[model samples]
Target: MTALIMIGAAVLPSLILLVYFIFGDRFPEPLGGILGTFFFGVLTVIPVLVFAAPLTEVLQPDLLAPIARAATEGFILAAIPEEAFKLAVLVAFARNLKAFDEPMDGLVYGVVASLGFATLENIAYVIGSGDGWLSIAILRALTAVPAHATFGAIMGFYIARAHFEPARRRSMLFAAYLVPMVLHGLYDLGLLATSYSGDIAWIVLGLGTLIIAVVWALRLQRRLRREQQAMLAGTAAASLAAGPHELRG
Candidate 1:
C-alpha cells in the first residue's frame, strides 16, 4: 500500500499538469504522437542519470573551489544537459507531426515530454525517501512538477514561434534553450545551496525562481493562445470565402 501511495503521489501531479496543458488546444495532435513523445521524454532520464555520475566524481575539481563546483552543478551540469535533451526530443519528435501547425502544438507537446520525465523522475525521488516519503512526494508534486511544466511551456513558446518565423529562427532557438536552462539551474542551485548552508532563505530563492518562471510562462501561453485564436479566425474566414470544400492545412 505504501508503494502504491508513493507511485500515486509521483504520477498524479504530472498527469494533472499534462491534462491541463493539452486540453485547451483548438486542434489536438493525434493521441499516438503524444504518447510517443511522452515515451521518449521518459527515456531522457537515462541519459541524465548517466551524465550526473561523472560530474559527481568531479565535485572537488582542481580549478574550482568546492563552492564554485557546487554552483556549476546546478547550471552547467544539471540544467544544460537536461534542457538540451528535452529540446532535442521536442524538435526531432514533436515538431515533425503533421499537426504541429501552430505555436500551441509546441507548447502542448513540450508539456507532454516534460511531464513524462517529471512523472518518472518523481517516482524515483519519492520512493527513495524511505521514511518521510509522503512529505517528499507532496512537496515535489507542488513544486518540481509545476516547475518542469512551466519550463516546457517556455521552451515550446519560443521553439514554436521559431517554427513559424524563419527570420528569427536563430534567436528563437537560442532563447528556447537558454531561458529554461538558466531558470532550471537557478532553481537547483537554491536547493543545493540550502543543503550546504542550512539557510531557509535558499528555499525561498528556489521557490521564488519557480513562481517567476510560472508567471512568465502563463503570460506567454496566453499571448500565444490569443495570437493563434486570431490566426484561426483569419484562416476560417479565408476558407469560407474560398469555398466550402477547400481544405485548409
Candidate 2:
C-alpha cells in the first residue's frame, strides 16, 4: 500500500506534463501523441535492460577512478543505458513524423516522450527506494522532471531545425543529438564527482546545467517566434506584390 502510494506520487507530476504536451498543442490531437510517447517509453526499456551488462563492462574500465568510484555499482548502470534508451526512443518514434508540424512541435512531442519515460522511471525509482511518498515526490519534481524535459526539448529543437532547413539538416541533427549527450554526460559526471569528493560543488554544477538548459530553451522559443513572424511577413509581402500584376493580366 505504501509503496504504491510513493510510486504514484512520483509518477503523477510527470504524467501531468505528458498530458499537457500531448493535448495542449493544436496539432493532430492527443491520441497520437499519447501513443507515441507511451510506445517509446516501453520500447526504450528493452534495449536498456538488454545492453546493461556489456555497456558496464565497456565503460567501467575507461572511466576515471573518481568517477568509477562514484559509480562503483556501475557507470552504465545509471547513465549510459538510460540516456541511450531515451535517445533511441525519441529517434525511432518521434523523429520524421508529419505530426511534428511546427518548430515548437518538436519541443512538445519531445517533451511528451520524455515525460512518459520519466514517469515510469520515477515510479521504478520510488518503489525501489522504499522511501516515503513525500521524498519521492520532491526528489522527482526537483531533479527528474526538469532533466528529462530539458533533454527532450534539446533534441526537439534540433530535430525541428533539421526538418525545416533541409540544407543544414545534417548539422542540425548532429547538434540535436550531441547537445543532449553532453548535458547528460556532464550531469552524470557531476553526480560521480560529488560521490568521490564529497563536495557540494558537484551538486551546484548539476543544478547550473539545468539552469543553462532552461535558458537556452527559452532563447530557442523566442528565436523561433521571430523567424515565424519574418516568414509570415515575407509571405504577405509576396502576396501583395502579386496582386497588382494579377489585375493587369
Candidate 3:
C-alpha cells in the first residue's frame, strides 16, 4: 500500500506531462505518442545496464581508487547509465519518426520518453526502498523526476532543430547530444562531490544547475515556437502570392 502511494507520487508529474501531450494539438496521434514514450523508455534501460555493468566492474576495484572513492554510488549506478540509455533511445527511435515535423515536436517526444523512464524508475525505487510511502514520494519528486524530465527536454530541443533544418542538421544534432551530456555529467559530478564531502554547498550547486537547465529549456521552447510560426506564415504568404486560381483552399 505504502509502495503504491510512493510510486503514484513519483509517477504523477510525468503522467501529467503525458496527458498534456495527448490532449494537445502539437503532438502526434494519441496512441502513437503514448506508445512512443513507453517503447523508448523500455528500450533505454537495456543499453544502460549493458554499458554500466562493465564500467562499474572495471572502475570500482581495479583502477582509479581515489576517483572511485570520491564518486557517489548514484554516479556509477544511475547517472551514467541512465543518460547513455536516454541518448541511445533517442537516436534509435526518435530520429526516424515522421512526427518530428516541427522543432517543438522534438521537445514533446523527448519529454514523453523521459516521462516513461521516470515512471518506471519511480516504481522501482518505491518498491525497493521499503520506506514509508511519503518519504519515497518526496525523494523521487524532489530529485529523480525533475532531473529525468529536464534531461529529455534538453535533448529534444536540439533534436527538433536538427530534423527541421537540413543544412545545419549535423551541428544541431551534435549540440543536442552534447548539451545533455555536459548537463548530465555535471549533475553526477555535483552529486558525487556532495556525497564525498558531506557538504551542502555541492548540493546547492547541483540544484542551481537544474534551475539553469529549466531556464534554458523555456527559452528554447519560445524560440522554437517563434520559428515554427514564422515558417507557417511564410508558407501562407507564398500560397497567397500564387494567385486565387492556384490556391485551392
Best by lDDT: 1
Q: Which is the winner by TM-score between candidate 1 and candidate 3? A: 1
Residues 71-157, candidate 1, lDDT per residue (tens digit)? 777777788888888999988988888888888888888888888888898999999999999999889988999999999889988
* Model 3, runs deviating above 4 Å: 20-30, 61-80, 231-249
Error of 1 at 245 (Å): 13
Which candidate do you rate higher for lDDT, 1 or 2? Answer: 1
How well does model 1 score by local distance difference test? 0.86
Task: Give the distance in Å from residue 101's predicted Cα in candidate 1 to where it truly belongs.
Answer: 0.9
Estimate the TM-score for candidate 3. Answer: 0.81
For residue 48, give model 3's deviation from the true position in Å. 0.9
Task: Point out where model 1 deviates above 4 Å.
Answer: 60-70, 236-249
Candidate 3: tens digits of C-alpha lDDT, residues 214-237: 677667667766776788798889
When sorted by TM-score, best at the front, the candidate numbers are 1, 3, 2
So what's the TM-score on candidate 2? 0.78
lDDT of each: 0.86, 0.69, 0.69
lDDT tens digits, residue span 38-145, model 2: 678656666767777675576664455765655543334655566566666656667656666678777776676667677777777777765465876786788768
Q: What's the true lDDT of residue 10 in model 2?
A: 81
